[model samples]
Target: MPRRHTPGHLPNDRLTELRSSVRERLGAPRPQSVHEHTPDSTHEQTTYSAQKQTHDSVRGPRTAVVIGRLLGLTFVLCFATGIWSHYLQDPLPWMRFPTRPAVLYQVTQGVHVAAGLASVPLLLAKLWTVYPRLFTWPPITSAIHALERGLTGVLVASSLLELTIGVMNIYHWYAWPFSFRTVHYALAWVIVGSLLAHIAFQLPTIRQHWRSRPSPRRGDAAVDVSEVDTGPAPIDRVQTDHVPADSVPADHVRTAGSDRRAFLASVAAASVAVVGFTAGQSTRFLSAFNLFGPRRYGDGPQGLPVNRTAAAADVLTTAADPAWTLEVRGNGIVHGFSRSELEAMDQSTEDIPIACVEGWSTSARWTGVRVRDVLTRSGIDPHSRLRVTSLQTRGGYAVSEMGPEFAADELTLIALGLNGEPLDLDHGYPARIIAPGRPGVLQTKWISTIEVIG
Candidate 1:
């Protein structure tokens, strides 16, 4: 025989009987007390234990919420960090750091790439946990929702395509003709704008949900109560009530089966993507360490083979400070760094690729003081745009202004080495510059003077 209940609350005797029945079924000790409480201040705490099972079923487990929260937090952090890594520079003055071989650049770049790859898994997990709500037609009533969706679509498409091409490029798989950086940069704005809007709309929802849930302690599972549909009781209680299928609705059975199949399909797809992405790639995505050392491809003029150019005048500066001065002689922008004084700042090295807008990338190992450190030593604010004068070039390279954060980008380096040896003359031997994810034109070679302008 099955137990049944009406809409009305159980009588006092029936409540007591229920408790006894539960204790016997579980072979557990009876509660210290068992009785229905009047709806009063005194009764709230008293009735808590008696209604534990019923309340638990209605509210769901604490573990479910914790898992959701962890997934959400991880995805959010990865997304923010990934975007910031691409856009923002590390704030540390690179010129002040010790100059090492370009191997350091390779390791850091690999980490950056790997973290990006891992985002696929993290993003999918987050979406899965929240996908049920997508069926609610329009999620938000305001125009903000439409704008957010638009931006998000653009960002998603851009980021995925950019990453895909980048991975292929690293492995020498060249099938795309478009300039990766140009396309990637243009799409980045869409993603960033959409991300900001998404965060804005979710702020209120996040706060409301946080307050309603109990503070999750360390090691305690986060419970997700937001998805609990208590609007109406489920008809087929196969899982909920352990009821036989004969008494359940056909729709209930169908829905449960569909959800199961969908979950399985999603898992299978994720496995395939991870495997397919790594196949035949020079650098394996699954490995924590990269076999390829730090070195950029095509640091010089693209399409042209490796060669040397003779400038009208040699502008190479040396450590010999007997008569060295950085002549900041352009547009009233005063900035100077003696060879000795420039050497006094911290040095850094990065093995970054010199990517050119002309459709090519080259690898090289750079060793020099950090440009940021040099600017700081010269008392120049990093926020100002810089005009770098090269000895081999007649004109200056007009680099845009970057906030202090850009100087901190570990990839930015004032290089002094090539291929494990001192810089060759043909290359920017005396001193050069290297910055990650930036076009080669910005990396002025044979650096003679750096002028700071507003």
Candidate 2:
């Protein structure tokens, strides 16, 4: 007959026999109950099986819930920062930068981009934790699920498109129509709407889990090994070998169809978000590529100088030709100059921002003859108005008139090389206007004329 432990009453021989039997049944690294025994008595032992199951069962979702909350908080922060950067009416309280419109615009734009990038890793880990739930297709689903799916679809499409185009603009890739600007602007509101809806849907679950908190700390509790074994059972069948709590499968029970569907949805949403987030900034890298490749400025008519219309195709010429002429007409003054004569004047270089109406900006080194030099050479007063023309006859040539002081600002120049080398055809190769603090359209390309007036 098998003997059972009865605490203080068991004899030494019985205790020894029980210990041996328990070890054999439950395997080594044996469960020990730290019951105090008199110096004359055998040591007491308790099983660990019950304690182990209780630990695993209670801690599994608690860990997941904690991580989910952290990730959700991070997501909220990312979105909040982006919106604040874009639309907040006032500067952050402690920020030192003065609230000039252009300065604020650039600073907020940079902050928005930085925050967006940071979201990638955070959202990825969150998705990993939540993805398992997507596989479960819930029974008795309501209209809410349908609504969630629709919102998710919109978020995915809008996010991908916005990220792609926004990145392109930042890098100055103009292959696509600027119409993307209008579309992206409208879709931003839609994205905000969906994000709000998502948060609302999750609020109940978030609050419920927060209210019912569980301990995250792991304790060194002894397991109840006896629960695993019936009398005379082999150790392997009775109990599992010790494994790390973290490695244990989260869901021992089979997942329902609804649960599986939920897991899949989470995965799909996360995958799209991370992919779009990462690929969206390729254009930034591309923009920086041109910075070191060539120098773009040179001696020429500067400011809004007009020139004869060349064949639009020839506007995309490579290697400067001696035939280049600048047309300047303003204040009843019309004059033309050979490329060599303009080059003979005092030349200088400037690093200036080329801002486009489409909302991109680039800094390039512009080496060129000053607008003052061209005006002085033509016997035209710097105070005279100017109109610049382009070789492309279809679009009316860009026009801007400025007084002597603004025209002669050191930041303004007519550029020949883009970064460090001569301009590439795609970027107005042979002499283009590059004025600082002005829209890109105001900078005429394919220089054929600069018409100036007194």
Prediction-by-prediction clash tally = 29, 70
Q: After superposition, how far is residue 61 of candidate 1 from its true place, in Å?
A: 17
Deviation of model 1 at 343, angstroms: 10
TM-score of 1: 0.40
lDDT tens digits by residue: candidate 2, 353-398:
5434333344456677777667666777765445566555454434
C-alpha displacement of 181 in model 1, angstroms?
4.8
Error of 2 at 421 (Å): 7.7
lDDT of every model, 2 decimals: 0.44, 0.45
TM-score of each: 0.40, 0.42
Candidate 2: lDDT of 149? 65
Pairing residues by index, what is the TM-score of model 2? 0.42
Question: Candidate 1, residues 390-432: lDDT per residue as tens digits?
Answer: 6653433423333334344565666766666665554554566
Runs of candidate 1 with Cα error greater than 4 angstroms are: 1-79, 82-111, 120-162, 165-386, 390-420, 425-427, 434-443
- Best candidate (score: TM-score): 2
The segments of candidate 2 whose C-alpha lies over 4 angstroms from its true place after superposition are 1-149, 164-186, 200-321, 328-338, 344-346, 353-364, 370-389, 392-409, 416-429, 436-445, 448-454
What value does the lDDT take at residue 359 in candidate 1? Answer: 23
